[model samples]
Target: MLHSEFYLFEEEKPLRCTVRNYQENDFQELIAIQSECFPPPFPDELWWNVEQLSSHLIHFPEGAICVEVNGELAGSLTCLRISYDPAHPHHTWEEITDNGYISTHDENGNALYVVDISIRPKFRKLGLGKLLMQNAYYVVIELGLDRLLGGGRMPGYKKYAENLSPEEYLKHALSGKLKDPVITFLLRCARTPVTILPHYLEDEESLNHAVLMEWKNPFK
Candidate 1:
């Protein structure tokens, strides 16, 4: 795939950043950014190794993108194409990712599956997350995919797990009555919760649960 350099202008300081495809030299930097974004117990063990990351880049080069700001690796969004069946059962992150290599990726798949997205802590709340999501939308259009699907970890749902069901919590998040750091942002990006996934990941914040979300391609 042909990659292009895109710029983002922050309202306050007008920072110049480029969003582009991953390269061989970016592996270690991506790992470091992932570590800083997701602290310990956030399942760093499940992250991709050099070989695994290489496999993704080889199979679906355009699916993985990195953000550079002031010549620093700031964030990245990794995805894969898969044949989706709404009636088919949903798979866990490990199952779909093949432990991170995305061995099951289907080149002709009509749905784009987001595998992971990470932003450095120092760069959070700077509109980078939304920028990455917008880029994903363009990818869907570029590939002519039907929609983008992913399991969103409910980082704030654990607090009400005993009191409210995942569906109930999602309703609140969708309605703007509740503010969940992750889900709220996804909602703002036009992703709608489709279902609740139990035991999505072994993390305290998610309480082993996630929300299956989708953003249908408007251009499709």
Candidate 2:
């Protein structure tokens, strides 16, 4: 039931939004959200599956969280703990996340690496993405992790690929001369850019590159 007639709910009445850890029953809706958020050309195989979702629950349940509006799933943020190496920080999403299964979750790791954050189409513009991210910050604090990290996509880069190198494009985007959908959003969420990683993922728009960002825990 790819792109099925689901999550098309009315928001006329007052809403009750709650953020909570992932549960076994939430997997189906989570998969549906993935399909809607990342359509074709986004590599269907990269979407979360039962095996990977189950692994999140078994290995790092606290790092898997979802936001619900009026009892319906609106968005989610899945992460894994890792002993991040600042000296050699270059790594692809596949290598870091164990191909999205997060089977390599390090319980005593120094950082919480965000594997994915997806918001439903209808739920956009409601600040759910930032809300999920803020909760991730709490996760870092509660677990005493040093920081939060992610390889952010730059979906807007393809538009300027012919004229600008990835680094140049990022410089412009950072300076407010241009805006990258993923990169800009992360910046607004208080994540600081660390470096640009080539071949970080299979994203065509990002030219297979990603911007590695971090949000250090103030409490650390």
lDDT of 1 by residue, 34-68 (tens): 78877877878866579988998888989888888
- Which residue pairs clash within candidate 1? none
lDDT of 2: 0.89
Q: TM-score for all predictions?
A: 0.94, 0.93
For all predictions, the C-alpha RMSD in Å is 1.5, 5.0
- lDDT per residue for candidate 2 within 64-149, as digits (tens), equals 89988878899899999999989988999999999999988998899999999999998887778998898899889988989999
What is the lDDT of every predicted structure here? 0.84, 0.89
Task: Output the number of the TM-score-best candidate.
Answer: 1
RMSD (CA, Å), candidate 1 to true, equals 1.5
Candidate 1 TM-score, true structure as reference = 0.94
Best by lDDT: 2
lDDT, residue 188, candidate 1:
82
Looking at candidate 2, the ten consecutive residues that score lowest on lDDT are: 1-10
- Report the Cα lDDT for residue 65, model 2: 91
Separately for all candidates shown, the number of backbone clashes (residues 3 or more apart, or on different chains) is 0, 0
